[model samples]
Target: MQINQLTRVYRYDGIDLPIPPHLADDPQGLRAYHATLYPAILNAETVDAGVIGTTHVTEYRRAVGTKG
Candidate 1:
């Protein structure tokens, strides 16, 4: 059987953000870490964009709405 190493990438504002090596397997940590770099991520939704090749893709989609 062939083995494929999994990798993660976060899509933000049409750009792919690479996760730090230390937080590669830590989803929650990466979210918080990335949030620091990108405040929008704090309110953004985390969605799996599925796997492409050997990499696993995730997207930080902003929640659009007007203040009520």
Candidate 2:
């Protein structure tokens, strides 16, 4: 999603993260409720065809008392 859109959504969720316009224009930008060690992954079958890119995986640390 675009940064403006993300900002709007975050506002609804009570989050106020400030994102720059340049990063929003980048092809590989994302926001998540959980902190990430890596980035997001996009599959060709899931996205528009003819687009080549790298998939970054995010690993969130489970909260205390949570069982994996």
**Cα error, candidate 2, residue 25 (Å):** 3.3
State the lDDT of candidate 1 residue by residue for 1-68, as single tens digits. Answer: 98889877788888888678998879899999989888999999999999998878899999999978
Across 1-68, the per-residue lDDT of candidate 2 in tens digits comes to 64321121112122333445665544345343212322222211112222123322222222335446
Model 2, residue 47: C-alpha shift (Å): 18
TM-score of each: 0.82, 0.25
List per-prediction Cα lDDT, in the order shown.
0.88, 0.29
Compute the lDDT of residue 43 as modeled in candidate 2: 19
Off by over 4 Å in 1: none
- Give candidate 2 regions above 4 Å deviation: 1-13, 26-28, 32-65
- What would the TM-score be for candidate 2 when compared with the true structure? 0.25
